[model samples]
Target: MSAQDSVPTPAATAPIDPIPTTSTPDINAAPHDPEDPETGEIEDPDNESSRFYGPEPDSNPSDGDSALGDYRSTRSTSVSSYVYDYQYENGRRYHARRYSTEYDLPNDEKESDRLDLQHHLFLLTLSGALHRAPISKNVQEVLDVGTGTGIWAIDFADQYESSKVTGTDLSPIQPAFVPPNCQFYVDNMEEDWTFDHKFDYIHGRMIVVGMRNWERFFQQCYDNLHPGGWVEIQDLNFPLRCDDGTAGPESPPMTWSSLMIEGAAKLGVDLSASNRFRDIMSNVGFEEVTVEHHAWPINSWPKDQNEKEKGMWVLQNVLEGLQGFSMGYYTRGLRWRAEEVDVFLASVRERMKDKRSHVYLPIGVFYARKPMGI
Candidate 1:
């Protein structure tokens, strides 16, 4: 195996291109009422303009607002129990550490549901494609790192029936009933990899917080792949972006995100690693590296139909994930009390529900390939 010291420095990659956030649709805009001259069918009203009905008169502003339309802003245990035992903090469950304490996310039923919901959001963004990599149909030997819930691996295995899929994670939370060709292993990628075979495609998604040494992780992916193989990573950039000056550095979303980044850094985890995956892959000797960016609005602030729909789902995912995402970082890393963490998160949640904030998360999808002559 190559040493981490040998990894070369890579040139900087392109900056994240900002997409224009659609302005708030005017509710008083004239509604469409004209009928089609040819078919005499009534034209449907503009969905974007009609999506936000605004807050009700009787609703309390402090009660919070929903991203959809209505207003409302709403781990533990043992070593041998690593399989059966779990740890609980602030009423949330986290997977017991088997080898490392690098991971900070929970693995219980709530997080599992959020993970699946995130997968659905990815599919919606990708137009139902499993991957953006252009691998051959005859390709086999696929591996999914940090495969929480084994949903992505299961779906990939089902799509590419001819290929074998292996998913590895610290928790044995994946379902036992899976595709015949798909298998799950309770292992940590930070440790020495013991795979007996090379793969044609390697994938990792939403794994930025789980890794302590991304250079080593990418080097392992490069080493464990065939000479001409592919690798892909999907994750969100940190410290939320806002175009309208609504969510500045002092805003709730930015404040909490920055705190989390600081906390994760104290634990040797990079919450903003997605911003540098391209450079890391290049430095690790991967060729033809490329990255694509997507917009994840914090609420239903976007005027475009597609982005608004995406925003609605993203809102729910973020709201559900706020507690789990903060518990580990705030309590263990930042040395904050559980109650303090909860109080801070409540303010962040309320801020997230406000469309006027115009906060959004930048999503990055990175892909690369091993040189054929390597």
Candidate 2:
């Protein structure tokens, strides 16, 4: 063999990790619902007056294209969202800001990133990747869609040695020393999926932003899953508005979350997608579906020191992960100036991390199961 042949060719053509540059606010033609709150002109709401009945699964598989609602949002991004790259930064070539679904995020939080044990772990366990389905055997033929850094998949691989674990993402940011049983892939889940084997379990977490169709995505999941399989989705609802009963929706806390939501919506991401989770799961023909709510303290102030420290860990993640995740929601939704967003997120981080703040963190998880025998 030639000396060139002796040199091993690259396995997969690694994707570029470019930061998205959509600074221009496309107000008039933006696809997001409602208005830029500050802009004073509102986009048409999705007939909110009409309640969402469950998504009809068996009707026409292709019908999902029309039946699914559009709530995706993507806005500004920052350093934290991609901070994992700093630790596992290999191919930071693509600055696309974010990648398609089929990615996985690990539970491998750093000592600096450690959050609450009861809350964050519970939030993660209910996410469909870790927990077993009441209907199916331990999740076999598992697929972690959008596995960021392949964290969840790696954990799943460690837990179920017999089961094959595949974590896929649009970006090639997974670590090199993954479990022998765990595998990673670079694929765009927003488009058609071409996998031959159906999965027993499909877990999608924190995929509210940058997603457009809910029905189609769930239907695709149903199609990709084996008979009687279970699919679980863990996502936040509208960023929680602090309710002291006197604070109106326009209060600082409410507006803070709102600005985050609005900007992400402009980018085809749905910051307020939790309300639709059940509707989409039912539409995809999933039966015995259920939703669970978990409260994530934006800052750690829960009266307990241990809980407080946990909150700090999550707060740090919020600080860093924002760049990778919600910065788009805040920056684009609120039309926040860079300095303004930086300052706000920084303060939120500091408060959350403050050992004395004592705040508890929370996020919601939604799960559903496909009925057995068709």
Candidate 3:
């Protein structure tokens, strides 16, 4: 059966199910009032002093690195004010100004640095390819959604000098210096798009957490693309897998994944939403849809040389950001205390380091073309 025939079309006005609520604080709840002055209790959601932990210190604070040392470091620049101003909650910082609280990731400098590392890791995974989509090099216009730090868009612009690239994100955390053909916009994509021109190519990477309605988001991509234009989505499916059964349900990584998935579900965020991208794109009037699956090992367990190298990068990527990734979701969605979340993650980190566990995540890449007649 064709992809289009396999999926049912969703009602446009259908009400999305709310994420299951827990005793913990509502993910969308407004910030609490300022701390109690006399009691010295931290009540304000924006109070940085009340953070459960201090910011993770950078091991190599300098931008440069030894040739043989860790991954290649990109020339880092200061965050720009063009992005949304930052706000803090439970000591973790987030985009202060946005259309909604759809995004759960941090928007601070540390997060940006991690995102840069993630970009390089992705490049390594794809063997330096920016995307798996069979897009034409002559394509004139491109739109990069959730273009954190604008690294991908900048690279795209640099590669396709003739093409104009526009990167948009909720936080104005991207660098000020960029290619001449590239520009950054601080905009929420979930809202009605008012771009003056349709794009020849649209790209979104690791934006699963930022979208509430996958069907609607795909429709928007369809509507915004020019005839025969292409859209590519790269995302990771959650709940790390164990092929060897060593890392079972009782394992720390597995346990952490379950809790994180639960937290995301309660917030109406579908971490595994990428699994349906092929069907959704086909149903949304797209054509020639294709899906490519890649496995990202949680540790260096693969015997093959290339897979082992990729595994190492993936391991480092996760280990470095594990705490930041867990803080918001656990504290807000699961309603766990900050210290409790930290302790749980410490155990999870140890589990991730175990080669016997053989845990890995599935990375999904979906690409489709807008029908020429549409």
> Which one is best on lDDT?
1
Question: Clashing residue pairs, candidate 3?
Answer: 19-266, 83-172, 84-172
Over 4 Å off in model 1, which ranges?
Answer: 1-82
Q: In angstroms, how far off is 329's CA in candidate 2?
A: 3.8
Task: Determine the backbone clash count of candidate 2.
Answer: 51
Better-scoring candidate (TM-score), 1 or 2: 1
Worst 10 residues of 3 by lDDT: 1-10
Give the range where candidate 2 is weakest over 10 consecutive residues by summed lDDT: 1-10
Measured on C-alpha atoms, candidate 3 has an lDDT of 0.69
Residue-pair clashes, model 3: 3
Summing lDDT over every window of 10 consecutive residues in candidate 1, give the lowest-scoring window.
5-14
Candidate 3 TM-score to native: 0.80
Candidate 2, residues 236-331, lDDT tens digits: the string is 566543322323465444555666667766767676766777777887789877654444444434333323333333454465555434444454
Clashing pairs counted in every model: 14, 51, 3
Candidate 2 structure lDDT: 0.49
Residue 268 lDDT in candidate 2: 70
What's model 1's TM-score? 0.79
* Number of the predicted model whose TM-score against the real structure is largest: 3
